[model samples]
Target chain A: MVLYCEICSLPVEFCEFGKSFKKCKLWLQSNNNEIYNKLYNSDIKSSLSKEEEEKISNSLAKMQLKEERKLERDLINLQNSKILIKRIPRTKHKYIVAIANLDLLDPNLFDMKKTCKKFASKFATGCSISKNSEKKDEIVIQGDVADEVESYLREFIDSNGINIKIEHVTERFTNKKK
Target chain B: MFKKFSKDDVHTRTNVKSSVAKTLKSKLVSQYPKLEDVIDEIIPKKVPISLYKCEDKIQLYVVNNEILFYQQFDDLIPELRLVHKYPDAFPSVQVDRGAIKFVLSGANIMCPGLTSPGAKLPEEDWPVNKIVVVYAEGKENAMAVGKLAMSINDIKTINKDTGIELYEYLNDGMWNFRD
Candidate 1:
């Protein structure tokens, strides 16, 4: 049986409940306990429409293919690609800045009009957006100064008492597909 | 876990209150000086906004919606018109966790946080005030009254704590359409 990745919406297979041809490591579980527990104890299992189930299964197949490709690419890159980690030329940040989270911390709702006002008012370098999986989830801010953004984010989250987990990624990010 | 909030010296970005209420969508429309008059060098004629909504949340469009960019705000309708959809807009509804408040009050508000189509068609860069928790009946299960910090697709891509919070006690409350 195929399950869905809650974050990426790609299909996933639990070693326990899914096809045992491959191992599932991205899951935050040792076994398919979360799925089993929910299935056995929840009200949602009975409501699975055939299409919904198939969608999830299709997602799983896609994910499995993606996993294989990613693994192969990683191996190939390890052998040929230079490991020189790229960094922003930290001379001075530009006046306007954009930041992103690897996990699509937010959807880009920046009021295009206000950019001028805000930029004119503040010393931002460039704008970074939250990164999103290809059409899979919300996009996060984008920025090389992710650390500074995190400090600001922590302040916002802390002051507001928000309980959310935010993460950052290294290496340059690709643009989001519309 | 929540940390202590230092309201006394909350070091915030200068224009960092609710941008919608304080700066962009302020109440006293005439009070503030017209920005165009204030700064002739910058400021565009019209800006775009990304809109978000909460439903079965499919197609996490994280990228591609933000043709316009600016500070985040709290309303989604004004931005809705930018997208070519039904010109008719959905009223912005505020609801407690389960949209418990609206479902009780009875405004075509559906979803745990679902309100309706905002003034804009759905876009990733849309601004928002709250997200609705919706049900299969095409009505709201609850109205999660929180600012849309991210776009509709942005929220869909991640595991939202508010969503987790909404689901925690969603079914426990009884519907009271009194409001």
Candidate 2:
């Protein structure tokens, strides 16, 4: 019989119920530790000293803090990172700068319309924002602004002290369209 | 697996010649011969077809605003759910739970997944080297469409790897492709 996980919709064999699927496992640990522990460690009962419990909790907090700091560092590095600018193929030199995974980004810090306007004034005649139904925002420019937009975004974001990284969706490429 | 396509580039055909329509219909019928009876019904006379030449290698065939089929690398294949609309249109094989991740990630269906206990295959006339749809064992929706790399008998008998070479699946360019 085929089995599936209620959580992620993955097949049960490829899920936590079976062997070696870490995605659901990680999701369970983060979202519902009780269920995760029950399913995986249902029979195990552990007795620990007060000092040991305190140490475990402290270490877990430390690990979480470390992860948070690493995330902050990654965000900071994104400001100085080179932007990926690309020309949308099959079009007449129409360019686009796609920024995906917006869910991971702070919505307050990033403004699609504001960024589009800034992109339009410097590089293109005008810009349009394509707001994806899937929540990703794409900024479309009429002309080539790959280089200028990258530097402009880096400087703008860095100066504003917004905890975000503006990355060009695709790698910068010279236009083969004549 | 998906590439962005502009809506402006889609070529809408308001009317298709009876001769052209017959030929196009026949082409689909030839690839999926079992659909010969109902092919004409689905693709009625002068049925509107919107052709989107998105990338150099991929072209999308949209009907009723939903992508019914796609042509990639010179081969025309129907979309998964489109195949599901007519359940018996093509032969289907079910993959066990172990193989869903790889299939969704664009990996070819492995032999073990299909030969596994929970997997199911057609009793007869497995379409080999032709387009067939694949469904995850417990899921009602067909997840992918691929050319069966090996016949069902061969797949069951041969203890080898890589069963179906999936061309398009959920989240692939064809799935997300639209005008």
Identify the runs in model 1 with alpha carbons over 4 angstroms from their true place: A1-27, A31-36, A39-52, A83-178, B1-179
lDDT of 2 by residue, B119-139 (tens): 788788574686678887555
Query: Backbone clashes per model, in order?
Result: 67, 1
lDDT of 1 by residue, B85-170 (tens): 21112222333222332332233332334332221123434444443223222222212112344455544455243422221111
- Candidate 1 whole-model C-alpha lDDT, 0 to 1: 0.32
Docking class of 2: incorrect
lDDT per residue as tens, model 1, A87-178 = 33232442223332223222233333343244333434433233334432222222344465556556655776644555543544333453
Ten contiguous residues with the weakest lDDT in model 2 chain B: B1-10
- Give the TM-score (vs. native) of candidate 1: 0.24
**Over 4 Å off in model 2, which ranges?**
A1-178, B1-18, B54-56, B73-75, B125-127
Interface RMSD, candidate 1?
Answer: 16.8
